[model samples]
Target: MKIQLLPSTFDENGTASRRQHLSCFVVDDRVAIDAGSLAMATTTAQKKQIRDVVLTHAHLDHIAGLPLFIDDLFAGLDAPVRVYCSAEVLETLERDIFNWEIYPRFSELKNKNGASVMQYQPFEAGREFTVKHLRIKSISVNHKVPTVGFIVSDAKTTIALTGDTAEMSDFWQTVNAETNLSALLIECAFPNELEELAENSHHLTPRNLQKELAKFNRKECAIYVVNIKPMYRDEVVKQIEELQIENLQILEVGQVYEW
Candidate 1:
């Protein structure tokens, strides 16, 4: 499968905001893992073809552009775009986001072609299921809100995303058990200095990341780090480099990798 990181902090060429705190990855150019920063990264036509969006959680940065994305593409899509997430995350999307107060509930709105804009595909933790050509598994993680991380595979490759988690064991254990993993895209929301806030908020600092990563017996997969807060990007990079992990790379917008 081919995965490309949309315009991120280090790779934006357009007039995108530089105070970055969001990300979106194009999986084979047909599926997106999250919709945070895709508003200016992708064109309107490409956004309409999105068939599957696997949400890590319902945090604003993670789902910021969700409403606009679905609304813009509502008329062009042949079928409703599938939004896969844990039950709790789905509830946040429905109640906090799509509720008429925030935005029209596109899940209830039918397009001119009689297609709903969004489809909720609730997923239980640890269940391995197939959707279209992808094999996906959700694993619960320690977060302030009920959240889940995902292990996605397309037969030949497995990609893991640790949405936003603190020092959590279940996710590491689940990753270690995966027999075929090609890459890991995890979030690091702060630098080591903000460890207290990071821990309380269920976000990760560089130190916590090092400690948690050591728990995984990964298969030498490419570990790409995402979600470094814009203000602390330099600090996070410096601290993370000092942690001395060999295979870690900072994920930037427009960076594409085939696995």
Candidate 2:
């Protein structure tokens, strides 16, 4: 598996930075974990190769760039883009995003191949599904909105990506149970001072993240921190460093990891 976080922010030099804004993690260039920064992070050819995308929730930061991505490829689709999500998320997307009021209902539209430009592949929580060579399962997580974290494996290596979530149990259990786990991508969005806000929004502060890690029994897998709100970036990173968690890393935008 190969994962890369796309460009979504700017640095002090006015050059594109990976510190803020929306993002998408592409695996093997064929499956995108989310489409948040798909269009901006990848090239036209890269976008065209994405045949499967599994969403964590209907939140804009996670699915914001999906509509435009589909639209851009509308005229040249070789096959329909299959979007995987929970039924709740699918409903929210259909009602709020692809409802025509916000964006065209690409799922209902077709390409020159006479096939739908996009399609929904709704999967229930806990049920495992396949996207090419990967085996994936979604675990419900404590987010303000309906959300899920994904556990992906390719037999030899397994990894988890917990999209915006607070201190939770089931997700940890799922992670610990994975024998071949190699990496974990989780969110730590606020600083210690903003614990209340983090909890209310179902996000994790570095303090909360410290407590969350206590639930895990294994330290073999690399834990990568993600989804840090731009305003709190420096503070969060400092706090995480203070925790001294072993094998922990901060995921960088445009950075790729192969396993």
Candidate 3:
């Protein structure tokens, strides 16, 4: 499996600059785990092949680029862009973001043949679905809104992404049961000093993360941390370093990996 964690931040030189941005991951050029920075992080060529997007939640940071991305590929789509999420998330998208006042509902827009340009495929948490060569399962996580973490695999190699969450149990239980798990991409959004803020917002601090990682069954799977707020990026990294957790590192934007 090949995964590229597209930068959540913007870069003036596009791919050449290699700057980081919001949370979006391109999975083998065929699927995107999130559309936060999908529009800005991807090149035109990469965009053409991304037929499906699996959203973890309805937060603006996660679904921000969907509307524009769909619009950008409006004329070229041979088929509709499939967005997979829970029903609650779909409702949030339809009510808040895709509604005409915020943005045109591309789900209602059509191509020359009169097919909707965007279609949402809702999945219940813990249910598994197949998209291309990947087998995906959504795990509910603790967040302020209705959010989910994804466990994606090709049957042989598997990886899990804990989308924004604070303290969660079911997600870890699910990950511990994955036999072929290769890597875990979890989020740590704040520094230890902001523990109160982290808890209130349903995010993790390095301290909270340590407790979370302790739940894992083994140390074999590589753990990469994501979603550190840009301003506190250094502090969070420093705090994480202080923990000295083995097999853990802060996820770098624009980085590509194969497992």
Per-prediction RMSD in angstroms?
2.2, 1.4, 1.6
TM-scores, all candidates, are 0.92, 0.96, 0.95
Cα lDDT tens digits for candidate 1, 91-195: 888899899999998888788888777898888988986666888888889899888888989968889999888988888888998888889988888998898
Between prediction 1 and prediction 2, the one with superior lDDT is 2
Question: How does candidate 2 score on lDDT?
Answer: 0.87
Point out the higher-scoring one by TM-score: 1 or 3: 3
Q: Lowest lDDT 10-mer window, candidate 1? A: 9-18
When sorted by TM-score, best at the front, the candidate numbers are 2, 3, 1
Per-residue C-alpha lDDT of model 3 across residues 49-143, encoded as one tens digit per residue: 89899999988888888988998888878789999999999999999988999999888889986767999899999999988889999999999
Q: List clashing residue pairs in candidate 3.
A: 7-21, 8-21, 8-22, 9-20, 9-21, 9-22
For model 1, which pairs clash?
8-253
Q: Which 10-residue span in candidate 3 carries the lowest summed lDDT?
A: 12-21
Better of 1 and 2 by TM-score: 2
- lDDT (Cα, tens digit) per residue for candidate 2, span 1-259: 8888877866788666858668588888888988888766776667768889899988899898899888878898878889999999999999999999999989889877887889999999989999988999999999999899999988678889998899899999888888788889989999999988887899999988989988887787799999999888998999999999999989987777987
User: Rank by lDDT, descending?
Assistant: 3, 2, 1
